[model samples]
Target: MRTIAIGDIHGGLKGLVQLLNKLEVRDEDELIFMGDYVDGWSESAQVVQFLIELSQKIECVFIRGNHDVWCEEWLETGEVNMTWYIHGGMETMASYDDFSDEEKKEHLAFFRKLKLYHLDDQNRLFLHAGFTSMHGVEKEVHKPTLYFDRTLWELALAMDNNLDTKSYFYPNRLKHYHEIYIGHTPTTNFKCDIPMNAINIWNVDTGAAFKGRITGMDIETKTFLQSDPVYTLYPNEKGRNKD
Candidate 1:
């Protein structure tokens, strides 16, 4: 059985379908999604539906991304901050316009039930975003894993900008897991490769929503497959522009 780890979906259902079709996934294959399953595209609702349906057919692990957390908040309170709406939540809301109230409730429940992280039997850890390295921070801290805590985000951003590998938060000294798969920060942050690892943190978000490709990593072979750009954004045509 082959194991494939896919990068962020970010509501790009067409892109997701194309990638899956290209992969020709088998029933015995293990498919793991790193998260950011919704927002930033016209089919957030459809994406969720597809994931729900796919879960029944295969061994699928869905990790929660920052956008998913915003979705949960909106579902629970019927209100969200402007930041959430500005960062693709508006698109997600648009996708749900045709849903019945009951359907919406069910969808929200599914989002709430998503796991914050998943660890494979191989000791490979999958999470939506980077974890805090500070002592006493729980392994299950929902805020940083789901949303960008300002302090942690800033620190990561700075490290990336400076290309300072030593500044990264190496989870458990990188010995606990063979590799850590993460999404949320775009792959553009690093040059040459879509997989960016800093202090053992591996970021796989390939910017699919901004017209970049969806990436799939084969852990055993250490190989990767990238679908052609299916979605486009303004300012830059290659999908490098931050939307």
Candidate 2:
């Protein structure tokens, strides 16, 4: 069975749809979504609805992203934090406003149930952001670290050779899994604009929230199937204004 890991979608339903078309996913294959499925583009609700249908058809492992969590908080309690709104949350709320009560409940449940990380059969770790290095990769990681840390990626990138061979290993961060895949830190920030591998760590968030394309990579082959420019997909509106 093929294992496909996707980068953060950031509410770009058009981009996600295009990227998935490129994937041509097989039923038996496993899908690992890196998350941030909302709060960037103009179709957050549509993106959630698509994933709901997608989960029924594919063996999907949905990992939680910070944006998804924030959305859930509002969905469950109607409590909107101004900070969230400033960072693309307004778009998500606007999109969700069109959802019916039942639809909102279903989407909220899906978001509330998302996992912070997923470990594949190959011992590869897939997460939305980074992880705490306090414990080994096999040990359970804290939820916040899973969707918010960047130090993990930095440590992996700075390593000489995958960290296993380092003479003075710092147990505070990465290279503990056979391979680690992350999304929070956009690859566009690194100027790659595509899924990139540093040492054994893969950074898949190609900044779909901004001007970059959404990415879906075949984990085994390292083949990337991407969407058209996300900004172009939503020409009339601003994506995450901060992207």
Candidate 3:
């Protein structure tokens, strides 16, 4: 079965749908979503509903992003932080403005059940963001780092395959898997549109939250697919203005 890893969606359900249609998914193909599925465009709820349906057809692994954490907290405590709202949480809330209580509950459960990271059979690590620390994926992990850290990517950028001898990068922070695929930091930050690889680290978030597109990669084949520019997909909305 082919293993595919998708980057952040950020409520660009149209892009997500287009990308999915472009992919030739087999029944046994494994699909790993890197997270930030909501909090962008005007289709957060629609995106979640689409994923719920998609899950019924394929084996899907979903990771939780920081935005998703905010969403989950809002659902449980009814607290809305401006920081989150400004970063597209407003759109997210509006997307669910009409959901029934039971539907909201199901969505919350889906978000809560999302894994922070998924280690595939090929030993590649798929996460929404980088990990500050890991002990065989058994130790306590900080969710923030898992959703926002770029240090790992920076480290990977600075080092070649000889990273083992680097002065920094503790053994705990060093690479231990075949590869680590992440999505929190967009490739637009690096002025690119395609997925990027440094050493064994892959950054697939093509800045869909800003003006880039949703991207998916077939890990086994190393082939990648991307949607049209996210801005065009939602002419009336701008997700997070990171620039």
Question: Which candidate comes out best when scored by TM-score?
Answer: 2
Candidate 2, residues 1-243, lDDT tens digits: the string is: 888899999999999989888888889988899989999899999999999999999899999999988999999999998888988899999997778999999999999889878886778888888766557544645657778888878877776663454556644445366888899998888888988787778998998998898999889999888999899999998887553
Candidate structures ordered by TM-score, highest first? 2, 3, 1
Q: Which ten residues in a row have the lowest lDDT in candidate 1?
A: 232-241
CA RMSD for every model? 4.7, 1.9, 2.2
Clashes of each: 1, 1, 0
lDDT of 1 by residue, 174-200 (tens): 445566677777775554336655544
Off by over 4 Å in 3: 134-137, 161-172
Per-residue error (Å), model 1, residue 20: 0.2
Instruction: Provide TM-scores for the models.
Output: 0.81, 0.93, 0.92
Model 1 lDDT, residue 101, Cα: 87
- Scored by Cα lDDT, where does model 2 land? 0.85
TM-score, predicted candidate 1 vs. hidden true structure? 0.81
Tell me which residue pairs clash in candidate 1.
211-231
Off by over 4 Å in 1: 134-172, 191-193, 197-199, 232-243
